[model samples]
Structure formats: C-alpha cells, structure tokens
Target: MDIRRWALDSDFKVTLTRPRFTDGLLLVLLIAITILSPRLLPVRSEGDTVLVRAGESVFRIPLEENGPHRVTGPLGEAVIMVRDGEAWLENTPCPLKICEAMGPVRRAGDVILCLPNRIYIRVEGREQTDAVSR
Candidate 1:
C-alpha cells in the first residue's frame, strides 16, 4: 500500500574501489618488460656505424676507421671512405655513379642509394630517438 515510500526510505552507503591490476600474470610481465626495456632497445648509434644494404645482404663498418671500405652489390662495387669525422661514398659502379654523387654524409640518417646496384647506405647514430611514430 505504501510501496513508493518504502522504496525511497531505504538509505544506502556507496563505496569506491582503488584501481588494481586485473591480471597478476600480466602485471608481472609488464614489470619484467619495463625492467628489461633498456637492454632490449636497439643500440643507439652515435654516427659510429655505417650500414650498407645490398639486395638481400647487409653490411656494417665502423666510421671511426680512417680508411676506405668497399661493398659489392648486384651491379658492382661501391667504395666508401670514412675520415676524421665524416663518411662519404667515393665511387659506385652503377651507370650514373649516382650513389657516389651523394657526397659525404656526416650526420646520421643520411643515406646513399644506388638503384642499379641494389645498394643502400646510411649512417647510424646520426640522430638518437626514443621511438619512431608513424
């Protein structure tokens, strides 16, 4: 007979909960990954490693070495030199020697590519980034 009054008279206490890890196993995994992130990250180069990719193959050389290095690609050989603080493509056997014309690249991310030779060259450590976003 007094249904509305009965329902409205009831007092309730509401409680809040602190955020917690829903999955213990996942929480442990996340902790482990965070702890290992430093070692697992790609080694940051200081423009010290010169990388060359020729078709299916990749090669690396130290920029600190003051001398010329040669990498043979599909077309022929590309010669690169490293000096006091820079590295450059000396020559490439491709038709235009286009790779050689790229000039010296001292900064990281700088690249020289020869399409005919399937050769790609880049300096590592030119710039250090925590992560790349696309």
Candidate 2:
C-alpha cells in the first residue's frame, strides 16, 4: 500500500498543440484587410459632385468648377463656394450663420444645413479618385 509514491509517480502528461488550418486562414484574412484598408474603405473627401437645395429647387454643381454659387430659400439667399475640388457654405441669411461656419465639404453624402433658412448644401456623387490614383 504505497499510495503516496503511486500518486507522485503518475504518468499523465500535457502537450502543446500546433495551430490549425483555420487559424492560418484567419491570419491571412486579417493581413489582407490591413494592407488594403486605405483603398477599400470610404474617405471623407473622396467625391466630386455637389448638390444645393433651396426651397423647391435642387441645383447640381460640379466640384471641379471653381466659383461662387447662389440659392434662394425662405429666409433669403445663400452662397456656396466651389474651389479646389471642395464646396462650402460661404453665406446664409439665417441669424446664426451656422451653415456658413460649417466649412467645406468634398465627400459623397456630406451636408451643410441651415434650418432657419430652409436650405441645405450636399455632396452627391460617386467616389472620385485623385490624379495620383489615376
């Protein structure tokens, strides 16, 4: 009856396992996403189209055409500027002028709103690549 010696001399052993095929596949996917992230993901200033809505009118403007544009709304007139591939709310009749301070927008789905004036400036177009990307 040598129970203490039998317990201390047990033959059980633990071994480490090698990585499985799924683990390798997951690692490859992660690396691919990391490398292609800049191109695949949407950016804030990657579009070249602009849309301005004032009252019942919708005006479509191209970002490449640099100039100041105007729109009329309930409160009066609003000015939008397009320059260097970007568009911004330059002036508005609303009391606070919040829309004018909203700064430039150059990406699809970007919008500047002047609730008091009943006007909005939006960017609506496909994502455009820069000259370098071409």
Q: In lDDT terms, which candidate is top?
A: 2
The alpha-carbon RMSD values of the candidates against the true structure, listed in the order shown, are 13.8, 14.0
Task: Provide TM-scores for the models.
Answer: 0.57, 0.61
Model 1 C-alpha lDDT per residue in residues 10-114, reported as the tens digit of each score:
674334456567766788999999999877876544477778887788878788888988877887777778898577776777788766777887667767777
What do the candidate models score in CA lDDT, each in turn? 0.75, 0.79
Task: Name the regions of candidate 1 deviating beyond 4 angstroms.
Answer: 1-46, 126-134
lDDT of 2 at 43: 54
How well is each residue in 31-127 modelled by candidate 2, as lDDT tens digits? 9999999878655556677877888898788899999888888988778889998888766778998888888998777778888988877787654
What lDDT, from 0 to 1, does candidate 2 have? Answer: 0.79
- RMSD (CA, Å), candidate 2 to true, equals 14.0
